[model samples]
Target: MRTRFPLILLLNAAGVALFMSWYLPENHGLWSTLDLAIFHFFNQGLSADNLGYAWFLAIINNRAFDGCALLAMGGLMLSFWLKEDPDGRRRIVVIGLVMLLAAVIINQLAQNLIPVTRSSPSVSVPGVHRVRDFIAFSTKDGSRDSFPGDHGMMLLIFASFMLRYFGRRAFLISLVIFVAFAFPRVMIGAHWFTDIAVGSLTAVLIGVPWVLLTPVSDKLIGLFARNLPHFTKMNRAIK
Candidate 1:
C-alpha cells in the first residue's frame, strides 16, 4: 500500500511521456482513419431518422451513468468511513486521496504534453463527401483531442477500488458504468472514438499495475472486514 501510490504515479508519468513522444503526433491521422471505418461499417444500418435517437442515447448514457458512478463511489467511501475504525478509515481516505491526486497530475501533464489545436477549416477524403464535413465539424468545432477523457479515467479508477473491495459484482457494475459514460463523449462530439479507446487503455495502464503493486487495496478490504460488526449494527439501527 505504501509503495503502491508512488508506483501508480510513476507508471502514469511514463504513459504520459510515451503518449506525447509517439501517440499525440499521429492522433489526428489515426482518428480520421477510424472515423472513416466507423462510418462505412455503420452507415448501412444507420438512417438519418434514427441518428438523432442514437446520439441522444449516447449522450444520456455517458453523462447520466458517469454521475451515477460518482454517486456510487461517494456512497461506498462514506460507508467505509462510518463503519471502519479510525485508523482504517484514515488509511483508506489517504490512499484514495493520493490516487486521485496522482490521476489529476497525470491528466494535467498529459494535456500539456499534447498541445491542443484550433479546429481546422476544411478536410477532404476520397470517395466520401460526408467525411470532409465530419472532419470539419469534429475538428473545427473543438471536439477531438488526445489527453485522455478525465470522466472515463476517473470512473475507471473508482470502479477499480470498488472491485477490490466488493468483488465481481462491483467490478461488472463499474465496467457497465464506464462503457456507458464513454459513449457520451463520442456521441456529444466531445471526443473521438479513438480518444475513448486510448483513454480507457491509458487508465488501465496506470490503474491495474498500480493496484497490483500496492497494499492499499488489501488495507482497504481489511478495514472493511474489521469494521463489519459496526456496519451491521449501524444498518440494523437504520432499519
Candidate 2:
C-alpha cells in the first residue's frame, strides 16, 4: 500500500496533465468524429417521456443532483470509517472531505481559466431536438455551459476517492454511475464530450492522490481531529 500510493498518484497526475494539455482540449479529427457519432446515436430513437430519458437528462443536468450524489458517496465513504475507531475515522473523513473540496474548487476555477467554446448537439446540430423538446426543461436562457463539465467534475472527484480505498469493485461501480448520470447532459445538449472528459480527469488526478499520500492526509486528519471533541461535546449537549 505504501509504495503503490505514490505510483498511483504520479500516474493520475500524468494522465490528467496530458489530457488537459493536448488530448481533450485540441480539436482532433477522431474526437470530432466520435463526438458527432455518439451524439447522433444517443439523440436518435430516444425520448424524454419514458425511461425518464429526457427527464433524466433535465434533472441530472442540475447541480443539486450532484450534491445528492456527493451525499450518497459520502455515506458510502463513511462506511469505511465505521469500522475504524473515532480518531482513525475522523482522519479519513477529513482526508476525504479535503480531497473532495479541493478537486471541486479547482474544477470550478479551472472552467474560467481553461474556457472552451462549444455547444450541445441539440443546439449545434441541425434537426436535433432542443433540450425542451425532449422534456419540460431548458437551460438558463439556453446559455452554453460548455467545456470540462461541472457535474462530471464533481462526481469523478468523489468516485475517484472511492476507487483507491475500495479497490476494483468500487471503481467499476463508480464508473457505471458516472456514465449513467454524466452522459445524459451531453446527450441532451448541456455539454460536449471534452467537457466531461477533461473535467473528470482533472478531478480524479487531484482528489485521488491527496488521500493516497501520507503526511498530507495525516495533517488534514489532525486538523479535523482537534475540532471533533468540541463537536462531540456539542452533540452530547444537544442530546
Candidate 3:
C-alpha cells in the first residue's frame, strides 16, 4: 500500500499534465477554441428565471467560502460527540486541510504558468444583482486572466477528501455540490468551464495521494490531540 500510493499519485499527476498540455493559450489554438466554446455555452444560458437556482448556488458557495472550515472542525467535534472512530474522523479533517493547502499552491502555479486571457460574458447572462439572498460574485471586467477557478478547486478538494472516507456515493453527491456552487461563477460570467475543470482535477491529482501516501495526517492529528488535552474527558467519555 505504501508503494502503491506514490505510484497512484504519480499516475494522477501524469493524467493532469496530459490534460493541461492542451490548455495552452496562444500556444495551442485548438484547445483554446474548445475552452472558449464551453465557456460561452455555460455563460450564455444563464437567466434570472433561475433565481431559485442562483439562490441554491449562492447559499452553498457561501457556506463553502465562509464556514467550510468551521463545518470541518465541527464535524470533527461531532465525531467525538457521536463516539465514532477518532482516527478515521481525524484523518478526514486533517487531510482535507492538507488538500486545500496543496490546491492553493497549485493554483498559484497554474495562474502564473498557463495564464489564459479572456473576457467574461456580458452581464445580460446573470449580472450581479443585489438580491437579498443572491450575491453574484462574477468578475465584471471582460478581458482578464481566468485560467484556474479557485472556488471550484477548493470545492473539489473538499469533495475529494470526503470521497476517501465516505465512499463513491459521497463523491457523486460532492460532485453535485461542486457543480451547483462552482457553475454559478461561470453562469455569472466569472470563469470558464476549463478554468474550473482543470483547476479541480489539478487539486485531486496533487492532493489526494499526498495525504494517503504519507503519515502526515496522522502526525497532524496526533499533534492536535496532544495540544488540546483539555478535551481529554470528552475523548474518554466517547470511548
Candidate 4:
C-alpha cells in the first residue's frame, strides 16, 4: 500500500490530464475525429441487408441482455466467495457492498459534476445506420444525453476492485467482462468512443485510486465486517 501512493497520484494526474486534453477547444477536432472513426467502424455493421447482424445487435442492446452482464459480474464475485473461508467470505460480502456504495457515489459525481453535455453519436452524427431501422426489436440505439458512460464506469470500478482485492487472474476475467459488456454501447452507437475511453476511463482513473490505493477502502470494509456480524455468522457452516 505504501508503494501504491505514487501510483495513486500518477493515476489521478493522468485522469486530470486526459480530461483536459479532450476538454480543450483546440483538441476537440482530434478527439471528435477519433470518436467518429471508432463509432462508424462499429455502427457500419448495421445494414438492412444483414439480418443476422441486425439480430445480433438487437440481442446485445436489449434491456434483458443487460441482465446477463450483471449476472456475469455476480458469477465472478461468487467464484471468490466460494473459495474463501468463513471470515474471508464475510469480508467478500462486505467488499461487494462497499463496491456498490462506491459505484453509486462515483456515478452520481460523474453525471452531475462533469460539464459535458453531448448526445449519442447515433442521434448527433448524420447519415449513420441505426439498429431499429433494420430490426423490429426494441433495442437501445441512441441516447439524448450520453456523456461519461455509466455502464462502462461501473464495469471499470468492478474490475479495479477485483484487482485490488483478488489476484491478477480475477482482474483479467473482470477485464474481459468489462470489454464484453461495455463495448456493446459503442458498437451500437448508443455512446461515443470518448464516453468510455475518455470520460469513463478518466473518472475511474481519478476516483478508484483514491479508494483502492489507500487504506480508505480497506478501513471501510473492515468497519462493515465488524458491524455486520450476521453476514459473517452465515458463513460459519462453511468450515
Name the candidate that leads on TM-score.
4
Off by over 4 Å in 2: 1-26, 46-53, 59-68, 138-143, 165-168, 206-214, 237-239
Q: For residue 9, what is the lDDT in candidate 3? A: 66
lDDT of 1: 0.54
- lDDT by residue for model 1 over 1-239, one digit each (tens)? 45666667887787566445435556455566775565445333324445554444343544455566677666666766787876677656665765575557655654555444322111222242222232222211123343366666666666666675557776687777677655555444445555556654565565555554577556655565565455546778999
For each candidate in turn, give its C-alpha RMSD to the true structure in angstroms. 7.7, 4.1, 5.9, 2.7
Residue-wise C-alpha lDDT for candidate 2, range 92-126, written one tens digit per residue: 76767676666666676667665465665566777
Q: lDDT per residue, candidate 4, 106-147, as tens digits?
A: 999989998998899999999988888877898888999888
Off by over 4 Å in 4: 1-5, 229-239
Q: Order the candidates by TM-score, highest first.
A: 4, 2, 3, 1
Query: Which lDDT values do the candidates have, in the order given?
Result: 0.54, 0.64, 0.56, 0.89
What lDDT is reached at residue 11 by model 4?
A: 96
User: Which should have the higher TM-score, number 1 or number 3?
Assistant: 3
Score candidate 1 by TM-score against the native.
0.54
Top-lDDT candidate index: 4
Give the lowest summed-lDDT range of ten residues in model 4.
230-239
In angstroms, the error of model 4 at 30 is 2.1
Error of 4 at 33 (Å): 1.4
